[model samples]
Target: MTDALERALASLDVRAGSTRRHTLPAGGDIVLPAGSTTLVYLLSGEITGDLALGSGCEVDAPTGDGRPVSGRRTLLAGDAAMSLGCRRLVLSSQSGAEVIVVTAEITPSEIVASLPGTVLVTGFARLEPAAAALAGNLGPRPDGLACERPGDTVVCRSMIRSVLLSAVRAWASTGAWPAPIADPFLARVAAAVEADPGHDWTIDHLASLAAMSRTVFVERFRDAMGRSPAGYVTEVRIREAQRRLDAGASVSEVSRALGYASDEGFRRAFRRHTGIAPSAWRARALTA
Candidate 1:
């Protein structure tokens, strides 16, 4: 499920990356001007803060908000509007604290659309024990090691993806994920598509799987997923192709495995979805 969410986000062009670590001294305040969407993960200590997003948006953390912030991890995810509005964002803590901020190069609306009802939109959530440990392990890593070398880029992406996936999964476990996955029919059909993107899927077949007529199924699916069934299937396939290519699979192999009639056919579809040929995308992805 996390993989599906990650792939969907990739197809939607939302790139997540770490920015910098911030430390707030005791009784200190840090004001930030408006900017992109940001995720702040508390690494240590306690803090309380408030934010004003332009005129109508405001986020408030009560005084001594993070007092006794032990064991579990505290996280705040929101756009610059909410975190740093037209005026500015202010952070203060009775005791000092350490936090890592990750900014995604997309607006709050885009993040909401891409992630649906996930925590990324709600702007706040707590990590469970295991998820907290995983996040803590990643908090100290350096940001933006240039991707000039394929190996280094892969490592950087892996780390970034791991943290993002952890965040998504934690929210998912809290039952805050979108309603589609909770629907029995949609869940079953989505599982089928993700499990085997190479499978030849038709509207009729998918409707049958969901025990619905074609007309009804198409309408329901689009309503729930925001895409036609066929379009969703194509997206999953492209994402699968991307994963395989990242793992060093050749174009021919990927094309055949994805059930494309020819390598050229796969190339064209890949370019349509990703804006580049498979070979070109692979080169850039390996070095981007």
Candidate 2:
């Protein structure tokens, strides 16, 4: 099986639509009304920020009096506020700071939903130690400015998504997997499933991995994933197939590779899950 981290990273795209670098002096502040998904990477200096996702507000490292905390970190926007109207993002610095803000093609909700947790809720949280390293890589490349190079924005987007996913997994490991799926044993089971969705996963096999009975595993899996074990497997299969289709694989090729009994069966399953045939989805994805 591929490493779980690799699989999770493979499941997301971070292509950027735009990128800009900013330098802020001490006491500098900026307010961005939500529209496009944004990632603010603090290149240097201390800063504080807040995220207003709808009426719910989350401040990064706020002080006793409820002021935003000052520290260098990464900020990810959750919902762009297109449907909800707009989120308020506030950033301030006590000292000078440099940041590169990138607008992604996809929203925070889309990224979070693809990952295992709601860790992107605020889209304004600090990155984990491991994720911090990846975020740090977003600093100016030795060759030249990132935006100066062709296709560099696309690469930037992938790196940002990677950093977010790493941080999310770290947060979830510290106790964020929901409900019945909160058990460490079940988390491992979930990881294995994601690591190799094409595996012939049965309730008994998954239960053994979790050291639980078939019935217990089934119940917990549904609670954590909101679906039966079989249902989850089907979803994973379809998602993998979707990724392949988007990458330009033929319908027959995807059907065979994902272990579908037949091409027609694969077509039926894909349509049932995505409301579009694989070929049609591919066409739309290519045009998109």
- Report RMSD (Å) for each prediction in the order shown: 7.9, 7.9
Q: Model 2, which residues run further than 4 Å from truth?
A: 51-86, 107-111, 114-196, 199-221, 242-250, 264-288
Q: Which candidate is the best by TM-score?
A: 1
In candidate 1, what are the lDDT values of residues 120-166, reduced to their tens digit?
Answer: 21233233344344444443454634335447535544555555545
lDDT of each: 0.57, 0.57
Error of 2 at 11 (Å): 0.8
Clashing pairs in 2: 14-157, 76-123
The global Cα lDDT (0 to 1) of model 2 is 0.57
lDDT per residue for candidate 2 within 127-148, as digits (tens), equals 2444455555675653565447
CA error at residue 276 for candidate 1, angstroms: 4.4
The true-versus-predicted C-alpha distance at residue 198 of model 2, in Å, is 4.0
Global lDDT for candidate 1?
Answer: 0.57
Error of 2 at 285 (Å): 10
